[model samples]
Target: MSTTALSSSSTGSTGQPPPRRKAPRRPKPAPGTQRISPLRVIGLTVVWLFTAFNLLVLYWLIMAAFKTPLEIFREPLSLPATLFERGTPFRNFVYAWESAEFGTAFLNTVILVAVCSVVIVLVSAPAAYALSRLGVRGSGPMTAFIAIGMGVPFQTVIIPLFIAMSEIDLNNNLFGLALIYVALSLPFTVFLLTGFFRSLPDELEEAASIDGASATRTFWSIMLPLARGGLITALILNAIGLWNETLLAIVFLQENANFTLARALFTFYNAASYQSEYGGLLAGVAIIVLPMLVMYILLARRIITGLTLGAGK
Candidate 1:
């Protein structure tokens, strides 16, 4: 009876409860794996601040463009009273357009940019190709000469350039500006293209030669196609440079009618007028920069890829 009672009590106790299990421990993160350094935090903060500042400036410009002179002066940094508050913005643009013959200026700028980009591509690509692949004598010396020209400032050559242009009756002409742009862009374009060309595999050219392709045929068929990305990069860069060019345009284009948009912007503030049209000026600037912004947005991915490929090797 005593043994039976003891066994029954023990069984009851065992059935009453079981001990709880603890969860498995997670391993700690490795040292240096999840740490944020102060330097990185500071650098990121600075970048954010600069980005915010630029965005604010852009916002201000866009807002101010639609405001009248009175509204701009009264609320320089404020938002527009209403979305439809034109305040003569369109009228100002129309006036500005007619005042400077901006249509002609636009046409001239387009032609100049196109012509210069084509010329630079045509001239620089072959020169760079020869320097990189042809094993021609004096290639090094020629490259060095071109590199030396890059170090020389345009200010140093402006007087001589002007005299030469005047002598050739090339001054005050869009053709003359296009020629100047091509020359100015050549050194850097050649340098960049040479680097890209040198990075290409020589085996490709060798294969083409074995297939009975002559040197010119090999370059045209194989090499040029391979170099398309680099060529596009060069074209975009040269176009931007030609578009934003101011000093040369100012100096060469003396006639009011021949003035580029950049120079035309100066007419907004005549010393004699005393009253500067700030709203119109800002609107004009926005207009001028819009095309570049659009181009960048459209071609940003391609530009990044091309630049990365060109730089990788």
Candidate 2:
């Protein structure tokens, strides 16, 4: 009944404190309701349509590969009867391989691509590591010069390269083509690997140095293992490009026996058109494309990962 009682009586009519005010509540949005832009909807529709069209085209190509030439045009969208009434479903493949010279061309391409890819990686990796990590003088300018080569058009050098190869008696020779590939591939390979090497941590090299490891030994033992992804990426890129390369093969290779898969396919297309053997033509096309397609599908994830490895830095 002292000061507390007097204050409570002054604040409210009774001894009790005034009622507390309730806070307002917000209404929740309806489930499954979302705002979307019309532009986004249109873009998604277009992309899905394009993807469907590509898949349809692939299906048609596969179906046509098993059909006769007449059936291919007449029943473009229909399934091949070969699937159900087949003696050997791969007759077209066999014909293309044996008669079209695809088998020999396939062998030549494998050897050339394998040798060239390895040589390109071997030559470029060390150069890239040196430019990126070693304290070499004029490394920046050298790297710029090397990068500049990538922009130079191969067309401009064709005449001179042909002349040079002819003078060396290497024209139409696989060895000469391999040399050109290695040389042309260097600029891009070195440039790409340099950035990847730069993105790697410097602490590893420092630790190796502290343990009395020489630069060469450290690179071979430590850095090389870390850079395997980049190297493999470079190798696969070169191999795929070289596999599908036609211009160089057309210009450099004259002998049918020396032809690559791409060159052979070109030749087969012409011959098959004249003979009305579209099935064999598609078979040759599949032969040229399938290996690269399979490889890409298998290594698609690895390739993407490798390309993105140093992107953050």
User: How many clashing pairs per prediction, in order?
Assistant: 0, 0
Checking candidate 1 for backbone clashes, the offending pairs are: none
Off by over 4 Å in 1: 1-35, 86-89, 271-273
Evaluate all candidate structures by whole-model CA lDDT and list the values in order: 0.80, 0.89
- How do the residues 1-313 of candidate 1 rate in per-residue lDDT, one tens digit apiece? 6997877776676665345698999898665455686666787799999999988888887887776677778898997663246454375566556655677777777877888898999899988999989898999999999988889899888999999999999999878877888888899899878878888999999998889998888878899889998999888988877877788998898777677777666654462135566666677777677677779789888888877877788
The sequence of per-residue lDDT tens digits that candidate 2 reaches over residues 1-313 is 7997789787887667788798888777564343675666778899999999988887887787788877889999998886448676777888888878877898999999999999999999999999999989999999999999999999899999999999999989999999999999999999989978998899999999999999999989999889999999999999999898898888999999899989888878888899998998888888887789889989989888888885655
Indicate the residue-level lDDT of 212 in model 2: 100
Poorest 10 consecutive residues by lDDT, candidate 2: 29-38
lDDT of 2: 0.89
Off by over 4 Å in 2: 1-50, 82-88
Clashes of 1: 0
